[model samples]
Target: MAGSIEIAGLGKTYREPVLDGLDLTIGGGVFALLGPNGAGKTTLVSILTTLIRPSTGSAHILGVDVVREPGAVRQLIAATGQNTTLDEYLTGRENLVMFGRLRGLGRRSRGRADELLAQFGLEQAGPRMVSTYSGGMRRRLDLAASLVTQPAVLFLDEPTTGLDPVARRSVWSDVRRLADDGTTVFLTTQTLDEAEALADRIAVLRAGRIVADGTVAELTATVGGQRLVLLDHDGTEVRSIDTDGTAASLDAALGAVPDAERALRATLRSPTLDDAFVALTQSATDHQEAVA
Candidate 1:
């Protein structure tokens, strides 16, 4: 059987190709797509959510072709874009209830609205107009509305773009809970830390192609192993030496340092997602330039 999401030779173009020939498979859990702006992250999400058709190739969500069976795909999935889709005129509770009604929940709409409001920690604000809510509150309500039908697949495009740290984590917790309940989440984020904190697996996109795909540790390894930093008395970095994260390698690198006592301290730093993202994307760009 095909995975939850499958793509083959996918391409989209406007003026120039926004997405080149791309293939990816995601089975389940929270799969994050990380890319800089204009990397086609949103374009891909738009394709999968049935909002737009690919210029070429094909994609499927749970074996339903996004192009051929858009209605079927819509039935199985829901999307929350960067902007909130909530109505400012409606109360938080009313917004969710309205979504449920549109989804044909009928008499069950009110109950489901209350349930979702409570799930997203918006029960107290449920009766308040969304226009009066904070940015975080509006975001939570938008997310809640997407779940009115409990979709099998959920697509979040930069779900926490403008929220503060606390609000961002709150959304992260909600995403985790959804995955735990067996919802396949496809997340697109520009924030490296968000991918590190939440992704079960991550793929980095550059120039409309995937340059790296793996777990946080796996991707970080692509950039190389840990780094040894020598710091001055003022705690500024004097030098950084790459290491394989073994004691032998650390010792060998340290031994070559002249006047080691001049350094006040040394620290081993693990390669982060940011490091991997930069190295991988830069490599891809360099390769493309060479090919051209």
Candidate 2:
């Protein structure tokens, strides 16, 4: 069963507040959390996954209160952290089988193990010791192990952080397939490309608050207007400007260039997700700076 997430006025405090007054609702699909280090991305994940308690407010996963009944919430979700946790002594198949049994699959464990092995493209490597697997392979096995119980929600923290392009794409495919099959995916990533490619909706967290949250296009539009891409014919220079195309805005953009009339080409385009992220985060920073 897929689930929706509801967090209301959630706050966690340690030294200072890690997460403060966060209120958000995430329905079924890929919900990506984009943030820099210490931006409360992982903290939010931990609270949602029942790994930690909130100091104030409440959160519910599929109507189950995360704080009031963490055990029940745990039964409905699986989380994979930044690091791998597989036993190197075990073979790929053995690891899956072990995890399946731990989840109480019992006699069905072997079949589930085979299914995951095939699903992750590890059928040929299933019998090899996990120590022999490469980084990407190990990550895939770790993810596959998490799915043994087929939880309603899956939290993947930095799932493809260290992967090469090919391996990253492979993980992307698996995530898409899971979401297609009705598992609500909550992802945290520092990679903008990963969030843009995978998230059906994204929320950018900064300084213990959500600076921005929406679909990629919606967030981009909120930052104001179209972007002008200026590229040199020799491919030596590329600059982008975000503006509403007002006379002042256009002039300011052009003024930055030494000779706008001599530019080889310029294209007026809609702002990308990257532009929205940077602009919104910068705006938040500026606001905090002014207050300080």
Best TM-score goes to which candidate? 2
lDDT of 2 at 276: 72
The sequence of per-residue lDDT tens digits that candidate 1 reaches over residues 55-169 is 9999999999999999999999989997558899999999999999988899999999999988888889999999999978888888999999888999999999889998899
Q: Over the stretch 1-292, how does candidate 2's per-residue lDDT look in tens digits?
A: 3238999999999999999999999989999999988899888999998988999999999999999899999888988887567999999999999999988899999999999999989999999999999988888899999999888999999999778899899999989989999999999998789998999999999878998888887888886776666777775336766668687887776665556544557767776776677776666666334322
The whole-model C-alpha lDDT of candidate 2 against the native structure comes to: 0.86
TM-scores of the models, in the order given? 0.88, 0.89
Per-model C-alpha lDDT, please?
A: 0.89, 0.86
Residue 106 deviation, candidate 1, in Å? Answer: 0.8
lDDT of 1: 0.89
